[model samples]
Target: MTTVAAELWDGPASEPVLTTVRVPVPCVARPGTTLWHLDGPCRCFVGGPPPEFAPSTARG
Candidate 1:
């Protein structure tokens, strides 16, 4: 699992909410494997995809 920072926006009028979330990391070239690829837009947010994301340095 990998942690990342997601900036979610409810709407144009509302400010973006920054939060941390854990997503599954894909294996090395595994066939029929599925994982949350963080290279693009994030679908985990309720409102919509996050406009920005980055790797989190915080440790558990």
Candidate 2:
């Protein structure tokens, strides 16, 4: 259950309205909308170690 969408138009075709802003944000989209930065940025984990097999195959 993860959603991020924007199509809230209230002007056109003698007002053929359509509104959808599945929320969770500090709002800013009301002049011609389309803005999605949904749950973005908690991604940075780079530290590597694991791959060591050579002491003539480590087995006396």
Candidate 3:
């Protein structure tokens, strides 16, 4: 398993929570977490390819 950062989004009525997930490729999170591969626009309902794994660039 690898460590990757994720921005968990439930729905329009909720906010996004940035966190880390340790899992193999092609994985899935809970149910409503909007998953997006850091490598690209690849979408995952639960989990998928782990991103490059990095902190938010906006926080320079």
Candidate 3's TM-score reads 0.18
Please provide TM-scores, in order, for all candidate models, with all chains considered together. 0.20, 0.22, 0.18
lDDT for 59 (candidate 3): 54
The 10-residue segment with the lowest total lDDT in model 3: 22-31
Q: 1-60 in candidate 2: lDDT tens per residue? A: 244567888878887889776443221322233333243311123322222221243565
Clashes of each: 0, 0, 5
**Could you tell which candidate, 1 or 3, scores higher by TM-score?**
1
Model 3 lDDT per residue over 8-42, tens place: 65555565555444333322343344333445433
Displacement of residue 60 (Cα, Å) in model 3 is 14
Clashing pairs in 1: none
Residue 12, model 2: lDDT of 86
The C-alpha local distance difference test score for the whole of candidate 1 amounts to: 0.44
Query: Which residue runs does candidate 2 get wrong by more than 4 Å?
Result: 14-22, 25-60
Weakest 10 consecutive residues, lDDT, candidate 2? 41-50
